[model samples]
Target: MNSHHQIIKTSPASLFLFCLLILPLSATCNVEKTVVARCIDQERDALLKFKHHIQSDECGLMDLWGNPGTPDCCTWKGVSCSNPSGHVIGLNLSAAPYQKTCLSISVFSPSLSELKFLKYLDLSSNYFYDMEIPSSIGSLVNLIHLNLSDSGFSGDIPHQLGNLSRLTSLDLSRNDELSAQSLNWLSQLTLLRDINLSGTDLSEATDWTQSIGSLSMLEVLQMDHCQLSTPLTSSSILYANLRIVSLSINYYINSSIFQWLFNNSNYSTVKQSLEYLDLSYNSFQGPIPNEIGNLKFLAYLNLSRNSFSRTVPDAMGNMEFLKYLDLSYNSLSSTIPDEIGNLQSLMYMDLSYNSLSGSIPSTLRFSGALETMHSLSYLDLSHNRLEGFAPGDVEDSHSTSHINSSNQLEGPIPSSVGGSSPLLHLDISYNLLQGSIPSAIGDLHSIVHIDLSYNHLQGPIPSSLGGASSISYLDFSNNYLEGAIPISIANLKYLGYLDLSNNYLRGDIPCKLEITKTPYFAKFTYNNLSGSIPIKLSYLGYNAFEGNPNFHMDKFQGRCDDDKHDGNIYLGLYVSIGLGFYTGFWVFCGTLTLKNSWRHAYFRFLDRIIDKIYVVVAVYLARFRRKSQV
Candidate 1:
């Protein structure tokens, strides 16, 4: 206000300097913006092409990258771009998440080629059938990962795929009648680390062997359900460097190849580096060679559900590093050797469903180390004839008891067994057992499943079992157990399946039957249980109470005509009675026939005599009438 100093302050030189300072940054930002816009437009075009390739009833133009209510192909599900500046780098227009069956490959958008910079592609689990793979797929040079699994793709793999030099992973599994005609080209993609060809039902060209031989640097290869008719190993180059491999569930598959591969007879320089192997559900037979001991690095092995039979090789126990071993459902026989105890690192071992007989090896006792072998979380010895000393059966009673009532083995439930084993599942059913459930079982709180059915077990169910909080499945049926059903069983909250039937036990249903955590979970059924059916048991299926004759249902009525059980017993009873009486009744009628044969000549004589007598009586009556009239 002192001197109205409103002089104009214009600095032309400073303005020019500022503009020069900001020019480079603005140009870089503008460059990025232009690149992003161009990429987005190309992505949209690519999506449109993809939509065109998809069949009707599959995604259409309206639901694809198009505007709402229209078949705009860009705004579709599973469409992604790399960065603002990247082309449509990902496209996942798969049909797995949908259950509709309409599938036509011609509906796929041809504009997908516009995504020239695409790096990832997934068209897995689409309900497509015999759709011709676009030869243009090879043009996606920037693709790093591609998955077309379970798309019902057929025909030969396109050699054009070799053009994807940057690919690191490719999965074309679960196709029908697809052969690896161009798999050799994939070997050239040195960056590829994983390849899955499972369930492809590949042809018998034997080209697959040559193709995989070249992938020296591959880390993981899965060929399960590939319909490879030959043994798995047909290697031209040694897979000594291979890490992870799976070739399971193939018909006519074999471990003979593995046996040959691991042996020095074929490739002396080869030393197997495999850590995991699965040769299950095959017909491989013969002895497990001793050289298998050389696979010291092996941690997991599965030879289950196969036809292999013989004594388990002692060499198996030599691999002290084993964590998992499954030889179940096989024909393996002979006593398990004590050498098994060498696998102190073992966590899981299943020898169930085998023909192995003889005493359970003391090695399983682990010298009272059973409680500390935490890694051994699951052990199944079911459905086998394993005989052994009952827990605490050793000579010295003062010594620490080894065999505990951990299992319901026959002879007797050694009360001491419950003191040692905290086993999760103990099933010793269908054996020549003669014993009562030991009360000591109440001490094993960690138990979850118990099956002592089909044995000679007797005695009341110990009240201690009610404290088994984690129990879920308990079966003591087909035994001699007696006494009233214990009420303590009500404390089992986690119980989902309980079968105490086919025994002599009689009692009123425990009131807690209504208090199951799951209302209709399961019930005490098929037992000698009487005193009215538990009302809550109405929730169970009708078949659940089949063997319990006294059980009744208030609403039960006759079943439909087709129901097999409909009046079947009554009808069978009538037929049996009729058949049983027919022979005797017919034999009595034969007696009458013999009577006629014995005195057949007197029939007319008896008739004559009877006529004479009748005539005399008539004459007398006539005379008497005449006299009365006179």
Candidate 2:
């Protein structure tokens, strides 16, 4: 530095730009240390002869093949090679963890069509006991994703898989004895985009919608329980990128297949790439159409158990990215449409066993009055025939957790019922609901199933409902509820199913419910509860302390009788043995049919007596002779 060393110099254009950037980064670190290619020894001996015709590798994936130094079948375990053309494209043997693997379609081998660049094949939930998906897998033909679902494949599906033609996602769902007679060889696969013949058997295909309408690159058409009762004609197969249309448990009673799947002038790109529309348990009846609000990007709309009747359509609140709306077990009557609260991205709304009557729609936070579905979570209007007055205006809906408005609703439960829930299942059972039992529903500390049973609900039972503390199923049965049973619901540590039956509830029974030991269902029967019973609940005998007539139980003494003394001793012992067998069977057949001399002196009685005497003498003599012979 002291000598003014300014003679720095490199030649030929800075040594040719430093050897052209270190010779392509030293040839990309020697091509990134190469190795990721060793698969093809004829596709690793055709996957070791398909794992030596595995008779059952319960998915131990053929013991991960020769792992001593990793004899690389593209590093095994669901092999997928082809870095530098090692070529065994992909073979994911799905069914690990939880599906509990069971591989054995003889390990699906027809020498795996020698992996001619196999393109993704997942043998899902393996156990092909009914085998036959192998028409040599239509010679692979570079398959593009084919998952044989729930494995256990069965016969007839092979029209040589329409010779692959670059299949794009074809899951033969569930398998249930496969079938699919003539889907006209699926119109030669025109690059199908997701076609799951769920629980296949396509009822002899009937050219299955003209071979899925010649799949104009269809998008997810799951034919659930494919006994598909055809009936959607006029096709040009315009599935301009259709998105998830599941004809669940098929028998689509032509609602014109919803105008041929919302055909806004010949399937307007399936209502803008329809998103998850399932015609559940199909026998689809009429009236879901307000043109289904033009499907504006629908998100999971299931017409449950279909027989869809009128009225749910206020143009389905224009969808607004609706999330899971199921018109349950349909017979869909009127009134639920407060435009379904304009679906602020609604989350799970089910009109249960429909006949949906009025009330509960204050902007649809169902009974929470009006939080306007701040992402409502599971609201089921149970067994509907609904009447009014549920709105006590609970405050904070915090994404409601299951509120089932059990039908025939009447007044009074609204004392800020759990203040708008963090609720976990609260069903207003068979309602005519009267008062008292809502100590804010114990402020629903994550309540767990609370059903105000057969209501005409009276007082007591709410020691703040044991502050919920994650209550586990508590029902106030046939409510006319009275006092006592609340020792904070016997200190609830996850109390399991407790029903205060035929309530007029009296005292005792709670002995801290024997210190909260996960009560596997305890019902205080005909409550007027007195004492005795809880010697650790005496193994819930005497039908959980029968009609409490001073409820005793040194092990159910005197068997707790009183529903009018066991219905008057079983109605006077079935009416005194049915009136003493109807008066000795009509007085011995009315004196032998109105006495024809007492029916010929009870007939043969006389003849029989005489014969008996004679026979007796003869038998005595015979017996003596036989004894002697013996």
Candidate 3:
């Protein structure tokens, strides 16, 4: 009986061991099940649904999915972020639909609505056949930005967008359906900071000022290129908060109307915050207001391509922060104010194509910021009546040149112009300044382009000129600058254009000279230059020297014999261009064999070819000359 009891107790021990082993396994299984319940089947479900939709679509979503349409729409062109879960916030599906056989709009991926946290939705740069915006966009309230611009949507914008209040920046530029009326729902949005409705036909905008003006926090309102019938002048206070404003290429062509409309808006306090203002290509006239200087914060002001008249205001000096000042293409007259130089931050300045006449200011120190600009290029003061050396001391290191007329303004250039600033471009043509060319002029190291034509600068040409190694373009034509062509000009490695026509400059051209790489054009016409046409000048035609009255050419086989060559030298230039190309090609080929490789094979080959060619040419030339003598 005791033995039987022991056996039953041992059997229970085996059963207990089995139950303990299964307990941990059960716990693990349970935990795994819980994780599965929590994890969303985002990828599998979304892709599966996308594939099914592409496989069968009644809304013709297959067109956007493209021909031989993929079963999985997410795999189509321009489609990104196929995950249905909120993990994907950016989706750029554009220009996917191209169905010539089935030209119809379709919602290819209805599962896109499954993405709850999409922040950026760009369907632009596409020919998507979407005539109406997908209504599911309202479901993605987590969106901070939504762009369906240029997606072929032609219907009115839905009011469902009023739900997107988190937007700080919005762009609907280049949309045909986006009009002022469709965007009128944006009046109540408080978080909006930027909005672009450019290229939209908003001419039918009703109560636009009352609607758009209420966006108090809006800093950039780009309704540029819009056809708005309503004048924004009524909401000057609304637009005053803007730091950058561009109304360029609009229909406000009436100067009086534009100014009056601009004045209707508060130009006083609002103008102060404006940093960059572009009113180019508009109809703006009258003297710029004295209040314009109130924009102390304004740094860049472009009033070019306009009809603005009267003298520039002295108050402009108050804008110490002003940097880029472009007043080109205007009728501004009178001498530039010495105070104009007070803009300490001034860097790029373009006063080209204006009617300003005067001596340059002396104290025009520029902004320190100019030193840091990587592309701070172009300072054009051409086509104006600015005479003498632009003010300031020629001794100043920054000055390109100094024109010291001594108030006895002569028709000849003064010698003191050598003291002016060393600008990249110096155009003092079409003036009455006259004097002998100063040797100090050669000291201008920063001079790259000089147009001293149509003046009375005379005396022997300085050979030291163009030794700076930076002169690229030099035109001394229509002047009394005489004497032989400066041999020192050969030092100009970067010279691309040389115009010396109508000058008293003489002498034969030098033998060893370099006139830039290709794409070079040089002129010495109407000069007293008497010498054989340089065989090296096979590339350049004659128009560059039309005015040289006493220029003569040596008898050469290559020189054009016809007097017609003198009347219009550029006549057969196009036909002769093939010669330039032919020579350039051969030279490039010869250099290619030697560059970097330093190949001994190439060297030997070239030496043999060159020697053979030289010998042959010499023999041919001697024979030809003997025949001529005979």
Residue pair clashes in candidate 2: none
- What is the Å distance of residue 293 in model 3 from its true position? 1.3
Looking at model 3, residue 174 earns an lDDT score of 66
RMSD value for candidate 2: 25.7
Global lDDT of each candidate: 0.66, 0.76, 0.62
Tens digits of per-residue lDDT for model 2, 1-630: 532222124344554555566785655323223233677667787788888877877647768675667777888888888787788788897884546766766546688888888899887887877877888889888899988888788888888889999888888888788886788888898988888888888786777877788788888888887777777744535576888888777765457776576653556667778888887887878788898787889899888887879788888898899788888998989788777788888778878898888776777544443456677766878888877765546676755555555677777877876775576887778878787776877888887787778879898877877777777777788879898876666667877677788988887765546435464778788877787776556766677667888877654323333334778888899999999999999999998998898789777797999899999999999999999999
Candidate 3, poorest ten consecutive residues by summed lDDT: 30-39
lDDT for model 1, please: 0.66
RMSD of each: 22.7, 25.7, 17.6
State the lDDT of candidate 1 residue by residue for 1-630, as single tens digits. 322122113255544554467787755333112223233665675565555655564444235346656332333567665544555677775666675443456444456666787888888776556765667888888999998888777777788888888988899887866776445786677777788888766646456666676676666778877766655453445455555566777757766666445643434433446677667666777765666666776788887887777888888878877788888878888877677767777777888887777777765642333533335656666666677544552111211212122332446656664654456676666775776888777665667777777878888888887877777778887888888888778777777778887887776666555435453455456667656545555577666656666656444333333344557978999999998899788777676567875435455677888999999999999999999999
State the lDDT of candidate 3 residue by residue for 432-535, as single tens digits. Answer: 55676666667667778777767677887777686556888887777887889877777778888887887777776653455775568788887777655565
Which candidate gets the maximum lDDT versus the true structure? 2
lDDT of 3: 0.62
Global fold similarity of model 3 (TM-score) = 0.64
The positional error of residue 367 in candidate 1, measured at the CA in angstroms, is: 6.6
Candidate 1: list runs displaced more than 4 Å.
1-40, 52-85, 92-106, 176-191, 232-235, 264-272, 366-372, 389-424, 440-448, 493-496, 514-530, 538-630
